[model samples]
Target chain A: MSAALPPFPKPQEALDAPELLQVGSGAEVDEPCLRADAARNRARLLDAAGRLAAEHGAAALTMEGVAAAASVGKGTVFRRFGDRTGLLAALLDHSERKFQAAILSGPPPLGPGAPPVERLRAFGCALLRRSIDELDLLLAGEPSAERRHTFPPRRFLRSHVALLLREAVPDADTELLSHTLMAYLDAALLHHLTEQCGLPPERVRAGWLDLVARVTRTDPPA
Target chain B: MSAALPPFPKPQEALDAPELLQVGSGAEVDEPCLRADAARNRARLLDAAGRLAAEHGAAALTMEGVAAAASVGKGTVFRRFGDRTGLLAALLDHSERKFQAAILSGPPPLGPGAPPVERLRAFGCALLRRSIDELDLLLAGEPSAERRHTFPPRRFLRSHVALLLREAVPDADTELLSHTLMAYLDAALLHHLTEQCGLPPERVRAGWLDLVARVTRTDPPA
Candidate 1:
């Protein structure tokens, strides 16, 4: 069975920022006088979380370890992040924000304003590259325990890709086609490419570009 | 980590003959020919096994239940199928052979003989159909713990698609591209369509056809 989406009570909170922390916290934290030391502590905690996730698995990450690494008290870490899963969710949000930026505005190919088809190819290629780069982070975000009914980044990514496909193909079922494309671009496929098939990154990107071009081209099926 | 494939082994004698029984003098008697009673017993055993598997799932199937359902001794069930795993394997084999035929020689589009693109489209449609019709059987055969190094059916299926792609896009790295396409058709994707996304079977098929046709059309990258 497919894993259920994460069940955040207010799903919109996860979808939109400025309200992200409000799902559980009830109100937005709009305090303007945040101390410099508080921001430093927050940065240190997030940094420690990333290092731990990269060095060990997400499952291995512990609040105690994070607190020790950040040189913060255990109570402060818990007060800031709640629990392990909560911390993991925050980590996912942090990574997704960075990934979203790359896709939306980072540079040529992956960024906006390029031809729809080329940009789509770049998106797939860049996603594969990022998957390879942040495997542990991606793996950690996987839905387990069947608790929530939230949208996955992959879902949003697929939807965005589908929007691009509408421009490329213009005639196909955009949503379903997007799902099909995302299915292929899954972490499993990326893992198989680099880990199982031993294909190099440039070669994988080239192959992806060819597939996108072939599929999105105006030529009728032979 | 990916599931390990099982090593292939020779078929056991118990599954080879369904109607044979040991006589008092250790002679193997063709029970279906000599004892009408023995033939009925064999049929009963198979029916019971099927029911149990359908009811409790393939994993939950037990020889003990088969014996009770068939009104046969525990030893007789073991004598017929060797063990629960063997029985499950045999059941899976029966269905797999039929599926292989459908893809390999059963019809146009899906079978060998159609134009490569049509064949590829048919292949995906057939696979997605099978994923819905035989989810359990498909799940059982994968990540099999035999022929461990062999690519999955999806991989092989994609390889076949890649061959077609090579014909259309000779310079592209179609091999890896095929892997990506196969992943798109994975059971998980099918589950998402039918179970999670709540789309009908035809919708998924149409999407696949459109995807394959569009992706493989002979167009240069934009």
Candidate 2:
């Protein structure tokens, strides 16, 4: 899962899995490995992206600057990510994966092995915390129509939440309820809290936990 | 009390009332004093909006076409509402007032004086029914932000819901839980169910009621 490929795969595979790596012990491997120069160029492109994101914000990143930083042709950068939108999505995916790992296995409360209700509360807080920390990354990963409509991460999060709620609350409508909870923590909600309401990220997380604890408990406080 | 004017002597006075609206004589004065021609134009605009929404979908409502259909200048349309975005918001507000009336005073289950749990279920169904019926209006009115934040209708609905939950499920964290319910009925979720999941709107409503009933009731079915 953590290997790099020598060349970009076919367009179909590229569309399906943006993160592709080629690794094997086959003599018939006609593709040359990533040259040291090519690897350096890739690293430079990524670094330039991070710097731009940090300084000017994600909305400021440009393909032209990325090409200049990587010392590559504009065509090369385009060929790699298709467009600025694609590059931004790929960058967002990196942070999203790390976030997924943290909730799935990294720590208590948010990770596995907590009381179901507490875990649900922790997951909401963790997600809210991440939204605050990676506002730039999230902004860059502009949710296109397709990503918002049909995506694995969105579905996975809902299913995970549904499972947790089913165990903790044991109501028949866990699936839809879980979906609602996921929507509550979605980009639109976060944007409203952070931008419109001018609420601090920590306060949002506190509200999330409060909601979660109340919803999941056997008998919520009056 | 049922007059068009506010309960207070003036609209500004109503702003300071304990409850949001006191439903007083001021409502009569606040009524739109549209000329016959202007009233005709307003109807045309709303009718065009509905037709365009029905045929081309919500994403298709543009300023130019709406203005042309209403036989008004683009500037007039902009003056009526600030922009295309504002026009959409106004359209939604129109529909929302009708919905608010229905839930607050129109009928059983949804109207006042029903069992709290039943009322809660009815409210969710009413909201879902309204969403499917007016999806374009809702989607168009969505504030252009990166995260989901509470809109006025959403907040009103949450407050109504919190009040009911406090009565029926008094032991639960009703305030946050109400938010969770509102989040589920968000435009995004409805689109997912109707467009992506291929579920009929009626089924979604039934599922919503079933889920709410299960959680609201104390004794579990064998």
Candidate 3:
């Protein structure tokens, strides 16, 4: 259906792209007030929160729970994060950096040691899994339509897909094809397919693999 | 960066779908109080508004202008549609129905006489043209996230595309592939590529044909 207004919410700042998600070491620059020990404490709390979210769900994570998990005062969590939104944002940034590092340098397939097609398959599957785990958290941070593509993390992921597609399908229009491929892995679309449409995560995963093959014009992996 | 949100605005009812767009008769059902001549007059006014919109972009549409163009009293325009929102919605529905009719029954390629691939190509080009014309109106009518895929008109178009895809690539999962194909023509994405990214409509149109070819694993048409 045609919308009366453009469907995307206009986003102001893009989500972090390449550099902003540089894992733990980079965040300290944004918080000059944190002395070394406090920074360590903050990292510890965040790590504990990550574990809590993984064990329960991102939706179940609470500042108090994180403190308890870290064996610190709830005040410590509050003093560090300010609010739930802040905590969740930081957690996402942490997770993004971790994920980025894993793909950028961690190992084969998702990293550098595999073929482009295999890498593309691994990337979508990995992204799908990460999205499913953090669906609620990711959904909340959605930007407006204008900024959706420019958002840093999304740009990074799409660029990665484009890179693989370039190698895999040298003759294809990988730029737009990248967007087509990334559209399948979009957080909102994935949420729609899995939660609203009642499609299973495995089915969604299979679909992504199928999509990669079609876009790359290759046979689907057996 | 990974979003804290899953990110789509969860829309409930899809923006008006197929039936909501029945040119004029269906709207009468919503207003049983109007007399025959009054209904005819109202439709006439809408027709004038549609002409005005096409001539001067939907963004330029105004009640005063619509009245002047329709050669009716400004009061009549206000009375008929109540507000700009109502009028635009009516206009969108009116336009949607006209478009639906053409594709469902009009002529070869776009209608039914040509092969499915040709029809598919015509369908995208025609949609791209319609979108370019009503970009603002359609965007304004964007549905909430939950209702987006389920939105009736979009579903109608996607089902149409899926039908073609099934014939074009019977082995593919046309259901998901249809979504993939539709994503290429998504209003938001089009707005981004054309307006934000500054890609011309022809470029986008080209991309769609290429995408269709790649998905069907066929060479681009001559």
The digit string of per-residue lDDT tens for model 3 on A49-138 reads 888887887778898899889999999889878888888888887788778988889798888889999999889989999988888778
lDDT of 1 by residue, A94-149 (tens): 66667777776788678788878778877887787767766656555654212111
Poorest 10 consecutive residues by lDDT, candidate 1 chain B: B18-27
Q: Please give the CA lDDT of all the candidate structures.
A: 0.59, 0.62, 0.75
Model 1 per-residue lDDT tens digits across residues B84-122: 766665555444445567666787867767777767776
Worst 10 residues of 3 chain A by lDDT: A1-10
* Ranked candidates (DockQ, high to low): 3, 1, 2
Ranking by TM-score: 3, 1, 2
Contacts from the true interface found in each model, as a fraction, amount to 0.28, 0.26, 0.28
- Model 1: lDDT to the true structure: 0.59
Q: What is the Cα-based TM-score of model 2?
A: 0.65
User: Measured with DockQ on alpha carbons, how good is candidate 3?
Assistant: 0.21
Q: Give the per-residue Cα lDDT of candidate 2 at A159.
A: 65
Best candidate, DockQ: 3
Given candidate 2, what's the lDDT at residue B206?
Answer: 54
Model 1, stretches more than 4 Å misplaced? Answer: A1-40, A55-65, A73-86, A101-112, A144-151, A218-222, B1-90, B101-114, B136-160, B163-169, B218-222
Candidate scoring better on DockQ of 1 and 2: 1
Weakest ten-residue segment in model 1 chain A by summed lDDT = A19-28
Q: Encode model 2's per-residue lDDT on B56-101: one tens digit a residue.
A: 8778888888888777788877766667766666567656667778
